[model samples]
Target: MNEKLKAYRAAILHSLADPSEVGIEQSYQYFEDGVLLVEDGRVVKVGAAEDLLPTLKGVEVVEYRDALITPGFIDTHIHYPQTGMIASYGEQLLDWLNTYTFPTERQFADKAHASDVANIFLKELLRNGTTTALVFGTVHKQSVDAFFEAAQALNLRMIAGKVLMDRNAPDYLTDTAESGYADSKELIERWHGKGRLHYAVTPRFAPTSTPEQLTLAGKLLAEYPDLYMHTHLSENRKEIEWVRELFPERSGYLDVYDHYRLLGARSVFAHGVHLCDHECQRLGETGSAIAFCPTSNLFLGSGLFDLDKLERHGVRVGLGTDVGAGTSFSQLQSLNEAYKVLQLQGKKLDPFKSLYLATLGGARALYLDDKIGNFAQGKDADFVVLDYRATPLMTYRLQQANTLEEKLFALMTLGDDRAVKETFATGQSVHRRG
Candidate 1:
């Protein structure tokens, strides 16, 4: 194909294949001194730097010395409107939603506000080295429009939607059931595959949406099963009690979503911190994903996620910085806190698994695995370069690191936006050190 194009040499480390692949761990990094060749923003060749360098005698290069390269972090769930609402007090999920989330999201009805937040939202993600995210917009169509508009301008792979809440929310923030379905359907038709943007059917949760609205949400998902489904699940006990009150005929919390045919490989739930064994079984059976937002869970006093039970169930889990309630947009921070979340439950989340969840696993959970998750040949050229010596403490520890795993563990625990030296999307430099 026209002999390819732009090339760069760096310390390249891509999750070369799915972690389930035979040689994923050892081969996670393709070449220590690696050459990543890109043509028209798509990766064409990946090999040893020394080998590929000689072939391209006069091409421009952006070499990152001693920087660790990995796939750009993929955030499976985040609320763009909640960007400024992070770090608010309290632990109850519902209270936090009503107090901070809904109020801030209400501002999205103003296009200027939506646009401003959308710009800041993307900048925060880029600063933290996340190239792709499944985001939630407010119940306003302008919010979805404003978000997609910003993503389109910035060329980010953003999946978002108009939040659907037909009842139990502030009157100003709610849409009627028919309007919810219609607005979402229109969004699907207009933005589902526009540019790198995709649409998600975002029902706030069972409590806010009536059965009619939830059923329409399932129908919309059925019409575009390829698109992602984003929502909340059993994040708290009181919330489960509220769901039972909302849908008394339901067997359990997750059954509320399942009753409407909203269970599938493409379905993704956020903050499943308190999901029980039966719920996990159904999620596993349907191949749906759970987005672990540890910081948010902790911020709101939600209990520790049962990582052991989830692992045993073979549930597909991904990492998220559920911004606003989540406390930070850094997936590195998500990885850091994810370790603590597991530790509290008497389980350990290995460093590799943490990083993998941020990259490939997150992409898989969103069903974007075939597209932008990892850096194998023929895949989209998305990469993040980390400066190992980004901070004084980290630099000191890197010298004492016994293995790549040790070095990575140090980075995950200590790293933040400072560690991100550069971010690339489709082989284009989206962010770089100042």
Candidate 2:
């Protein structure tokens, strides 16, 4: 009954669990005429409009008709420095890194360039309805500082860290193990847990980092156990072979991180496209996570992710755009690619499950599920409003969809940034379509 509370009315939907694991009925919550009440940057109440309206006297109501409101999309893995180089033609993982990724990332050494790009990158994310992301910065410590600076300005809940690489990269991009550790420690002290921001311990990958640098990265994680550890895994076969050559004494690609004490509950490995069953088992047992980046995988010709296999093995998985190599920033489009990737393997990614991966499932992967994933009481009020009729084709398709399932399927299959009517973070509107 506070005057500060704001009420948003729309058709609401959010995931309770992975539908592939739990049945759809138990995994999702949808309300046709829902009212989400927000106050002081948190969700105060959520229920049928008719039921809550009587109790919300004197509150400002924002009406969104024929729109679907869901928890804001969370990108589990993305490279913030690669925003400018997205969609570069040809080349798979390793080559793509050297040619497009490295050259673009090298520019981040300039503080102004890093600041400018961080502003653009976060705006692009807000435009696409992504409220939170696990991001990667360049090797320069300034890049991480710049990114967190921009994010802090907007009061956004974001996670990012500087790339740690001391070998197998251009001289301009490499940092010594000691320098990497000191830089990461300094940045973490400055930014980690500063309001809504968090820090990630980022080792680019096993091949790019020497054992010394990786050991230091593991040391950082051991020191800050609550912080996140993010890096690349078996994205491509050649890359895996290179990792084997780099750490020949190790049992495998995943073993390199395991041996260095880098595998744990707070760790997230991107693009586990060719991971073996043993690797998956280890990931599950250690409470680590895999970020399934279908858009990047298909664009770079990396192998298809065995989503079904990973799930069956009890591995926690989430969705990512993996920009630069990834084709789109839209999580809906990411879901579209995810659906196709599974289809090629004769498996199905349910529409509900795809949305889950983009939202709650991703939060779970980042170990932030209790804070930002759903419309649970007292959670942060970050969400997106989707215009089901954003496109002429979507309008027609939605007209014929009678059931909620069919309507949701059409939205995921046809939606993109154009479908995002508005995006909000912590009960404040950040981007609204004209």
Candidate 3:
């Protein structure tokens, strides 16, 4: 009976547990006809519409007859500065970075240019039903500043950091150990824990950063206990060899970061495509997470991620578009690529598990599950409304689905940005499809 409450009626589904840990039947909850109630940007309740509708006296419900509502998608790793260069042609990881990524990121040295891309990048996320992301900016401090400004204006829960790269790259994009540390500290003080924004100490990777820079990056983590440490790991074969050459004293690629004291509960490493069993075990033991970027792996010709092996080692895994190399902003597309990635290795990615990785799994990886993932009471009301009939093909395909699992499988296989009918952040509509 609360007048301030807002209600929406739709078919709702959300992940409650990882299907890899729990059986598929016990992993998620679904309501054929559900009602989500919100007040002051928080979920008040979510239940079957028939049960909740009868209890309300005067609350108006916004109903979507042919749509599904689910927790907002989360992208665990993305480069905000590379939004313009997605799908840049035919080079593997190292060459691609030098050819496209570094040059494109250099443009962010201009605050105005960074601000302009931030606006477009965020809107693209909303359009694709992604409400939260762990983003990477250029070495330039202004890139992080501009990215945070746009995120704050939208009231989005976002984590970003300035790239810390000191050596083995173009001089134009490099930052000294002292300068990188100082700039990152300034950004953390200005933006970390400011509303829904958080800071990450970002080292490009083991090869780009010297031991001095890596040590200082770890020091930042010690200085701010709640901050995140984000970086790339074992994504490509050449990159792994490069790490070995750079840090021969270390045991392996992960040991370089480990030697610098970088692995922890808040650390998130992107593209663990080439990780060994020991590396996976260490990641789990330290509570570190990995971003499984399927599209980027495929596009860059990086090896397929052994998701089954990672799960066996008890490591937390999440979905990352890894755009521009990732090729699409849609989590559905990421899920689609994920399915194929698993298929190549003779493993299966069930539809429930796919949804979990994109939503709750990503949140857990980013250590924000308690605040933003799923439709739990008291969590932020960030969710997406997806239309089954978004396109002629989708409408036709969904009509053939016999069960919720079948419907979800079809959506992940065929859906894209067009399937996102509307996106809501904090219970307020932020994007509506034309």
Candidate 4:
């Protein structure tokens, strides 16, 4: 029998458990001098350096000295087609979709364009230290195919779907109800659970989907066990008003999805800022999570999300950089911006809480906590190693940090892609540099 190759000598720091389950500080396990043994694609063992270092016999070692290692950031929501339209001029969510998003998404009908964007999108994600994401694709079926194809090549755990907007969108972007479900189901059968890929049942928003179209989306969700549902909900007051006009028979915005049975664990609704108290309660009760896209909310003049209020609603909240609308791709930047977003709401948000939202919080939202989002024994070794002194300012700032939290706090506020020293996925070296 052939001996398995091994890579050792990597710093190990990961969420020990659900921070929400055990207060944030206790939830993390960081080994100052640590070692991870990787064989094949999964993490075989992780422990202290003194114990693991001695086992190295003819094995390669990646020693990222003084670099802080943590699980890769998980983005709960983003639009793959919006890669080119991320920083377009000022407009609210609805208008932004019409002027920038719809026009940009329409181009996905071309397979070449989709493939090109897919490649660039995945590169940007890896560069920004994001290992997993729930992405939105154009209504074109090719868009999902291209995105999944790119993710597969990169070996990323990506969740995305074909947008379904049967009405209330540009004619070019809209698809018949039948075609939307069929294409989505086919994509699901092909990609869901296929080598780190998961398909999301995507509806642009309640206003754009007819009762029948939404019902069809709900049907798809019911049929596919373990599949995720993605959509926009109560993002803006104007959009909520439009939804009210569209679904007046329902009690509120969330009710539309609730009635369709789309409110449950693994259902991710982005930009839930305007959700009422009752709506928040429903989301919490149903176990549906909200992706708090602080950057996009601020970029589009969207209202600040009530994270404190929503968590009280028992809603699991995660972070997102609603790209294009979201000012940056780096989850570090998202954490930085999320701090200010909560600050503006007169809430006291500690930096650790911010980091938790980006990492472990997202894992919980996606229900992938058991697998990714942390570095534990028997879990995938998906983490990014960051240089505390990645830049001149960060190097200078390191002097002020005496403790781990202080160092991490400085990193979130003062870091970007340049801070990523190395990135690893499933025990493989995907990005390495300082």
TM-score of each: 0.95, 0.99, 0.99, 0.96
What lDDT tens digits, residue by residue, belong to model 3 across residues 44-98?
9999998999877788799998899999999999999999999899698999999
Report, for every candidate in turn, its global Cα lDDT versus the true structure: 0.85, 0.92, 0.95, 0.85
Please give the lDDT score at residue 191 for candidate 3. 100
Give the deviation of candidate 2 from the true structure as CA RMSD. 0.9
lDDT of 4: 0.85
Residues 1-434 of candidate 1: C-alpha lDDT, one tens digit per residue: 23448777777766654454444465376577888888777777778988888887666666877578888999988999888777777758787777877888778889999999999988889888999998989999989999999888877888898999989999999998899999998888888899899988999988999889998888888888687889999888899898888788989989989999988987889988877798888999999999999988888887888866875677888888888888889999998899998888777787767777899888888888888777667778888889988999989989999887888889899999999998888877888878
Clashing pairs in 4: 86-324
User: Which one wins by TM-score: 3 or 4?
Assistant: 3
What is the lDDT for 309 in model 3? 86
What stretches of model 1 exceed 4 Å from their correct place?
Answer: 1-4, 17-27
Indicate the TM-score of model 4.
0.96
> Which residue window of length 10 is worst by lDDT in model 1?
18-27
Error of 3 at 375 (Å): 0.6
Worst 10 residues of 4 by lDDT: 1-10
Using lDDT as the measure, name the better of candidate 1 and candidate 3. Answer: 3
